[model samples]
Target: MAETTTDSVLVTESVAKYDGAETARKQPPPEKPADVRRRSLVIVSFWLIVLCLGLPIWWQTTTIYRAKLPLDDMLDWAEGRACRPVFPLRISVEANDLQQQEAQNLLRLTQHALDDLNDFSGHHLRLQLSPPGRQNESAEIEDTSALTIRLLPGDSPASALHPYSSILDITYPPNSVPTQTSSSSALATYIAGQLRSTFAEEQAIISYLLSTTSFSNEQRPQGLTPEAAESLAKRTTRSLKYSPTYHLTFSLFTGGHQPSSWDIEAAVDEFMRPVLDVLTPIHNFTIDTQIQLYAAPSVQSQVLNKEDLSSFVNAAEWPLSPSIGGAPTVNFIAYIGNQTIGLPPTDQDASDGALATSQSWLVPQWGTVYLLPLPEDTTHVSVLTLKQPLLTFTSHLLSLLGTPQSGSLPLRLSTLSRIRSADLLLRASSTLGSLARLSLALPSISIPSSVADGVAKTMAHLRLACDTLGTPEALYHARVAEQEAERAFFEKSMVGQLYFPDEHKIAVYLPLLGPVGVPLVMGLLNELKAWRKRRREALEKGKAKKDT
Candidate 1:
């Protein structure tokens, strides 16, 4: 009986301990209506502030700044719809010996023939008859006139471009002159044929440029054959882009200590100055020469083949950096070595005369490399010895500048200006188009106000260039357009912002929002539950009171 009583006492103690624990763990009384409403207001206010003010402020602070761009206008410029390139060449005909009426008739017939022969409408040739006995034809004619034609009566029909002037001198037989009643004349045909041949290279270059672009079929010239186009493509690739100035570097590299110096300054003054002066109207050149002794070439062969010639330049070891300005550099290297170029079996004999051994080779648009063989004891290169090399460099320079091969120096320079203008205009247009396409393809990229400004400036310059296509001012405007387009296309801010991703945004928002949002949402739910219970209890009490 005593043992049972002790067990009952222990059980009572355990039950008492459980009762105390339950009483301590019980929830407090339900919240009052005013308190519930206050908590709800607090939660709602927090969410309202976050949704309306904080989020907007955060978005505005973190968002990229994008200026408005004229995408439609940019696309139009790129598609060749904004501008049409037209090269209007004015040719003046001078017939001092013939009557004024005769010269006018000759000019009219030649103009008709040229028009019929020309398949490319973008490049038009208009001929004008000069007054009789007009002295100093070149000085009197405006800069707009590309070429002047002089008609002289002679025994045989012959046509030749004047070596010093942009004038074509033609000698026609007396019988070749067309009578007043004649519908067509032999003289007119000869003049048209001559003019066509003279501008053939220019036409081919322009047509090739159009073919490479996104030009429509109507704009493209009809006569470019596949082979012709391929050849033109090669030439275009080999030439450098047009620039206002070129840094001309003359480097003399030698394998040994001997022949360490050269009279390059004297040689340039004697032979190259004249050509540079002629090219001044189109381009300016800055010259600096250096002598590098004990310098090794990339290839170590005594007899270099055509394949070896290409790799002879050691670009890594050479100090041929371009000038500081926006001008491009042209390197002319004269390496003193005894290496001979290996000729093919057909050219093995010197007596063949058909294939002469070349001492130098042109490296496309880069420059010329002359393998000048000097005596082992020689310490210096004389100005006389450098004459040949300088002359070769001059010829190569002309080719590098994209000068037409079959004309006088003056005529070629004029042609070069026109070609450069056309090339730059197309290049700028293409750049603008590329930028437009890039912007369209990459929507996340930021476009700054500076980029928009540059695009606007480019378009303005491009329009100016188009209006004055054949003049020097046109070249200047095209150059500016090209620069501005390049600047806008490669804007630094746009590129820098492209790498940021959405993952970073999620990482930033989750940490701050998670903690604050969870408690506010739970508190609001609990408050609503208490308010609903209170309303139900009040309704029950009201019903009981009515029954009583």
Candidate 2:
């Protein structure tokens, strides 16, 4: 009985404790509509800040601002569709001895013959008769006339080009003169043939240039001989890239210490100054001279072969640094040594007659090296001794500047201007094409307004250059176009910006966006799930009421 009573008391105590614990549990009131709506509004407000304000701010800071460009017109210039180059050469005829009517007839007949002979349409030689006493107007004629043909009577019909000026002296027999009634004469035919021969090389070179470019079929030059084509190709390759200014470095390099000084300044002033003065209107030159003693060549040969010429320059030790400007440097080295050029190995016993005439070798696109076999004990090279080398350097300079070999000095210089203009025009066009292709190739690259401006300037100047293809202005405009196009194409900021790829953007933004995005997303999702549950419960309750 006592055990049962104890057990009942224990159970009563345990049950009382459990009932007290259950009564002690607290339950808050149900959430009001106003509170729940306020919570949802807070969530929406946060989302609205992110969607409307935050995203725009982020985009504004990170977006790439690219200026628009005239891509199609640029492409047209690049592909040679915008302009075709045509150079009309005007030749003035001075017939002081002939009557005006007779001179006009001869000019007409010669032009007809020239037209029949000329196959290159891009180049035309139009003859104009200078008024009788107007021939003394040297300034005006020099500016306009490409060449002046002076008619002089002689024992036989002959034509000779003036060595110093752009004059072609033609002597015609008294009977060979064309009459007003005659349709043709031997003098006219002779003049036409002579003119054709005079410009034949220029025509071939221009034709080759056209043929090699994106020129259409009609503009291509016809009947270029294989020999002429080969010669032009060599000439083009041998010439240095054109610049408005050139830095000529006259260096006297000697392996020994004996010949340490030279009279280079006097020699240059005598041999090179005249040509430079004549070329002043086209190109500018700045000269400097140096003497290098104890200078060893890269090739340790007593006698140099044609093969040794390639590796002759001691590039590692030579201080042949380019001048401190945009102008290109040309090194004229007078190496004082007893070394001579050996004939080819294929001809062991052949006469060294042809090789003896040339103590120097031309280094294409660089400069010339004249091997002066001075006495071992001699210390100075006089102005007389440098005459041959200076003359050789001058000749090489002309060749390096792409002067045509066949024409007279004045005519060659004129032709060089035209050639250089054409070259620059083509270079600028090619650069534009490359830039266009590059823009297409890299879409993510940022284009600045400066780049667009440069491109616009390039195209503008390019159009002008194309219009004035044969004139000096063509060269000026082409140079400007080239410079601007290169600047635009090689924009450092654009090239640097190209590397900031999409992957880098993601990496940069991931830390900030990743953490902020997850919490906002999860909270919105939880709110949505709770709202869906509430809607389902309300629908079930409405169904149950309808059933009742």
Candidate 3:
């Protein structure tokens, strides 16, 4: 057994020796110069291709798409430097009772008084004497006149605005008319005061807009007192942004199965259609009504406080999604509950008439809510019952659309168009500015070509709107600019990839590149070293032969 074991060990050693010798014998001889040169050339070619072609392809594929924009111009628009809004109102003066010379003199004095009283340069009233013969053609002249002044001699100086027209009628004593040489007169001052009072709301609104934006102090009007500014701010905040259309939603929310249905369609048609028809020139309306049963309010107190009104809408469970379109939704919710808002003094309620009322409350930029207390057995709400609520909704709707509080329906709608145009213009400019600042702050963020196109379109439309303000076309252009600017600022590609860091990109690429790059680089380096040594040796040999 010992001999056999020894034989096995000897056999293993002999086999290992034979295998080693066989492998050594099979090994090829050292490479020739041509073979070595070919190998070096192949490695060099591979490295050159990688550096020159592969690297460029990789860089091109991984690079972000950056589009050029007029950053400076966009910033200028945002800062209110590019466009200075000016409202040139032409007030026509009619003095059929007085001579041409007297009318012209009165007009000059009133205009001077107006200029002295005016603190805002952007909004100015220019008085023009209507041609004496144009009195019969007042309809033709009405198109041009922002306001018309009709003078009549009376016992005392008193002024009244024509409720139906933008006409101010003043009964002045004969002595109140300005003489040819008189620098100032009571009649002129009275007219100026009336004009200021007539435009008080408009002036306050425009001033509020300027003050809210980044307009320079020089551009804003000075007459906005803190109290007035506060009031205007509330009104502005209460109003929704300008839109071509608005979705009117009439919803009946009930805590129980009773009062589940309402005649909302008839109520809207009867009480709201006239107002909607009048608003057609400035805005369009789409109506939809729904009945939600077993609905609960967020707050259940019998006497809801001021804060409770804000949370009354059960937003989580309520189907109050905005209409699936560009237009914003105005929700008119009629909740069936006995909850009453705690009463405040007359002064407190006056400041917040919409929200403090027991009948209904208006939610800023959202909609109105009416708490309806019904009998336990009541199931269907009649059109008559819905009348008061619908009327309340109509009045609040006007406020939501930013209509002038004081004016005939026609005049208010006209003012709405102009106000909306200016609002959209300023909003678009502000958005452009925001986008410009964002781009500057984030240099690495990739701005896609679509964003550039949108920006270009916005600026072009903005210019057109700025030049044609107060006209319907201006509102169209302003809307386009606002839409385009919003689109550019919210570009999905730009926003989604804006925060991706360089470290993340490197981490993603390292695994694929490390194994391949090291081998290729080391092979090239070794070949270069060998070639350099061979060249140096050849140079030394040549020198030795020459010396010999």
Candidate 4:
């Protein structure tokens, strides 16, 4: 029984009977040449379509677009190679007491002396004779001049600056007027010296700015002292950045319940209004006032120190919100408190040049704070009591605007314009350089057409500003250039398409192409091998037939 079961398991196939001719295996008939050619053509066509159509479409979809930019010109401007700032200051000369010919002669001689004395190429003083009581070209030049020299017949030669305007009052001897035949005059030399003194600080500051920036040694100011450079550095750090408009917030902060009301409007009108009017040509100011009760300083000691002033502002508690519409705000605070500021031993005379007084101290780039010691029961602050603080504020405002300390108020204001122009020009150039570098470093970042347009406008306005450095128009153009450069550098759409990880790309593309590509490739390879085998068989058969 066991042998029968094993034999049944071993019987896997049934036996078949066939004739002798059927025992020989036979091959299928050979494929026709047309069919062989058709298979090759199909494989080639499919591969050609994939290579020509699919690859190009994929590349076009993934490419990023970049707008053309003036990169070379932008870099040139940034490195101070494209434009050298030059200030052409028109100076009008007038002498009502002298004849017109004498006035002309005096101006010519003074100009010669000035040319000999000036070494800086950036600032040029062009002397023009103002026609007496005539509304013509000379009058127009007078209106545009940076300064006016008014000559008067006097016992001796002396120059005095007009406190209210940009006029240099020069009194000279009667015989000091130059003749057309004379090459020089004592009055001309005296006037030249006065002019040099007037613009000395302005020239130094501009030179300091250039030398510290990207300018070459030749373009730098001829003589800049360490003391002057240090002073300029302090002023630069202390000043607020350039802005077309500044909001002035006059706030009265109190620790007690008293002094709820103040005559801030009347005080500003009486003391600070004139300075604001003078600065109107270069800057615009909007004034507002507020009172905050129970406001305390960050430092609560009865006596405050110099170090305490740095953190005096309770930033979290103060209602000193910034101004809107893209303009900066400057704060002036009068704190009614019993605490007195204790100056260090070395800073006893801080009021002289340190921008601090016994009762007040200036916060760099922010504003000024005055510790006003008032009676505990006082309810209203009078304008009379605010006279000194307001005056202090007026002076501090000029400092905050980066005004030179050595010049008179009018001359300082005029210098303010030139300083601001240079500052804006340099800032715009730096912005352009940064943008260029950013584009170079990031090959994949998209550059929008608006950025290119902004760069174009910036360079154009920068050129205009460089051509008219000393004029008011230069300031306007510089402001525009700076704004445009910033806009170009900060364009919102410059970030390109979202990033796709390599792992994710592989995951997506492998699944898509694996099914379609693998079969095509394997089929073509197998067809090539089979064709070679067929050729070998045909050659072997032909050789055998020849032998027969």
* Regions of candidate 3 where Cα sits further than 4 Å from its true position: 1-32, 133-142, 254-263, 292-298, 315-322, 345-354, 373-384, 407-409, 535-548
lDDT of 4 by residue, 1-548 (tens): 99998877666322222333355445457798999899989988888888999889988996767899888988888888888888888888777788888887888888899999998888889998776864344435435888888887899999888776677889999987777899878888889999999998888889888878765566667677898899788889889999999999999999988899999999999999999998998999988899999998899998877667777889899898587577888889999999887875457334323355688888878899998999899999999999988998988888898888765677788788899999999999989988988888777777888999999999999999999899888899999999999988878777433343357768988998899989988988988898899889999999999999
Please state the error at residue 285 of candidate 4 in Å: 2.6
* TM-score of candidate 2 to 2 decimals: 0.88
lDDT of 1 by residue, 462-545 (tens): 999999987778888998999999999889988776676778768998998899879878877886786688789999999999
Q: After superposition, how far is residue 346 of candidate 2 from its true place, in Å?
A: 14
lDDT for each candidate structure: 0.83, 0.84, 0.85, 0.84
- Reference-based TM-score of each model: 0.88, 0.88, 0.85, 0.83
What is candidate 3's lDDT per residue for 431-473, written digit by digit as tens? 9999999998887789999999999999999999988875667
Q: Give the C-alpha miss distance for residue 248 in model 1, angstroms.
A: 1.2
Tens-digit lDDT track for model 2 on 1-548?
Answer: 99999999999999999998887765566678898889889899999999999999988987777778877887777667887878888999999899988899999999999999998888889999999997668557857888888899899988899888888999988789888889877889999999999988788778888877765566567888888788788778778888889999988889988787889999989988999999887789998888888889989888877667767788788788586587889888888887877754344221321112257766778887788988888988999999999998888899889888987999999998888788888788888888887788878788888999999999999999988878888889988998999899889888897667789878988998889999999989998997898789889999999999
Backbone clash count for every predicted candidate, in the order shown: 0, 0, 0, 0
The residue pairs in collision within model 2 are none
Clashing pairs in 3: none
